[model samples]
Target: MESQSSLQRLLSGPIAPGELAWIGLRPARRASMIPVSAAKLAPGEGLEGDHYISSRNGPRQVTLIAAEDLAAIGQFLAGAGAQPEQLRRNLVTRGVNLLALKDRRFSIGPVILEGAGECAPCGRMEETLGPGGYNAVRGHGGILARVIEGGEVRLGDPIERIEEDISTVLARRRNR
Candidate 1:
C-alpha cells in the first residue's frame, strides 16, 4: 500500500488546463447540433440558441466531453469516429479530466461553471454512433455543469480550475 504522504503527492500537482476545441448547440430536441465558434452562456439557462435554453435551469444546463475521450471512443468503436456534434455535448475540450471537476468550480473564457455530475451516456447514443455507441460512451460521457456566471465562451478558450474553500464554495452555490 502507498503511504498517505505519497498519496497526497500523487494527487497534488498543478492543474492541467484544457482548451475548448469545439462548441455545438442543438436548436431543437432530437435535432443535430449546429457547430459554432463561440456562444453565450446564461445563468439559469444553457447555451444561447440551444433548445435546452428554456428548460435547462437545473444542474445539467451544459454538457462537456474531453477531446481525448472522443478519440478513445473512436478507437473503441474500431475507428468509427466520434464527433463532438454526434455526442450532443455543448463543449468539447482537450487536456482536462472533466471528472475531476465534479463539485468544483471552473472558468472557461469569461464564463464560470460549477460541475454538477457525470454525464452518463444516454440511449440516444446508440442512434448517434450506431451499434456499440451506447457502450462506447458509457464511462467516457464526460460531465454536466451549470453556468454560475454568464459570459461568452469561444473556441480555444482555456478551461481552468478555480481554487476555493469547499465550505465557501458550497455556501455560494446554495445562495445561487
Candidate 2:
C-alpha cells in the first residue's frame, strides 16, 4: 500500500489577496469539486475568487499558486511551530512532486486537467503569510490546469496517476 502522505489532495491560497480573499468551501451544496485551470498570478487571486480556476465553455477558471512558495510557507510555519495543517491546503500530495506536472496531463477522477503552466507567487504572500513568503515559490513551476471533465473533489482526495507517466514528465523538466 502506498503511504498515507503519498496520496492526497492540495488546494490553497494566500490568507488575503487583492480585493481580499480567503480559502474556504465554495458555495455549491452538491458540488464537491471545482474546475482547475492555469492563469497568471495577478496582484490578488486565490482558490475561492472569481478566477480561482475556471473553464472556457463552462463554470470553471484556473486555480493556481507557486508550489515552492507553499513549501516556504510550510517551512516558516514549521519553524515558528505554526501548525502547517492550520494553513488549510485541501490536499498535501507527496512524492508526485507538483513542479514536474507542468504542461502535462493528470486525471482527477473523470476530469482530465492539462497542466498549462506555472502559478507564481505574488505580493499577497508578503501581505498574508509574511514578507518572506513572496520569495518562497518564485519559479517552482506551480501548477495551472483546466478541467476537461467535471467531477467531485473534496478534501483529502488522492492525487492518482491514470494516464501518462508524470514522473518522466516531471523528471524531464527537472533536468532542464
Candidate 3:
C-alpha cells in the first residue's frame, strides 16, 4: 500500500466555503472597472465583455480578491480602503483565505477556476489609491486564476474548493 505524503495531506485540508461578494470588469486596458451583479465566465477566454477576452487560454483569465484583505488594506492605508472597482479584481470573495486556494481547483456557483498565480500590484496602484498605493496592495493584491469550466457567476454565489481524493493528490504530487 502507498503511504500518504504529509505534504499532500496538508494540501488537501478543508476550508470553510466563501461567498462571491462583488464583481467588476474592465472593458479596456487601464479603464475603470464596471461593477456587475452577474457575469459569464468563458472557458479558455475570460469574462464576457471584459478586456481580458482572448482567443487563447492562459493564466490570469480571472482575478479575485478577498474582502477581508480589502479591509486590512484599508486599515494599512490610514482607513482609506479602496473599493472593489478601484482594486480591479473580477471577483471579490469573502470569508475564505485566497492564499489557501493556491494550486487548487475551486468553484464559484457553476464556474470552475484553477489557481494560476498571484495578482501582482501594478504601478497604477499609486495613481489609483494615492501615495503608497502600490505598497499597500503588495500582499493584499489577491490572486489570478484560469477558467476551467466556464459558466455564469453571480454575487452571493458560494465559493467552494473542489476536494480531490488522497490517492489522486498523492499520484499528482509524485508525478510532479
Which model scores highest in lDDT? 1
lDDT of 3 by residue, 1-176 (tens): 99779997876778999999999989998888999999999988889989988744788889999999889878878999888887889999999999788778888997878888889999988888889888889899899998877889999999988887535644664586
What global local distance difference test value does model 3 have? 0.87
Residue 85 accuracy (lDDT) in model 2: 25
RMSD values, in order shown: 4.6, 13.7, 5.5
Write down the worst ten-residue block by lDDT for model 3: 165-174
Ranking by TM-score: 3, 1, 2
User: lDDT per residue, candidate 2, 1-176, as tens digits?
Assistant: 86344233332211111111112333343233332332122122223433243314321234433333456556754553212222322223333556545555554423345556665655655544565656643554245665543444443334543344656645654586
In candidate 2, stretches whose alpha carbon ends up further than 4 angstroms from where it belongs are 1-60, 64-71, 76-78, 81-92, 162-176
Q: After superposition, how far is residue 129 of candidate 1 from its true place, in Å?
A: 0.7
Clashes of each: 0, 17, 0
Q: Counting only residues 3 or more apart in sequence or on different chains, how many pairs clash (N, Cα, C under 3 Å) in candidate 2?
A: 17
Clashing pairs in 3: none
Highest TM-score against the true fold, candidate: 3
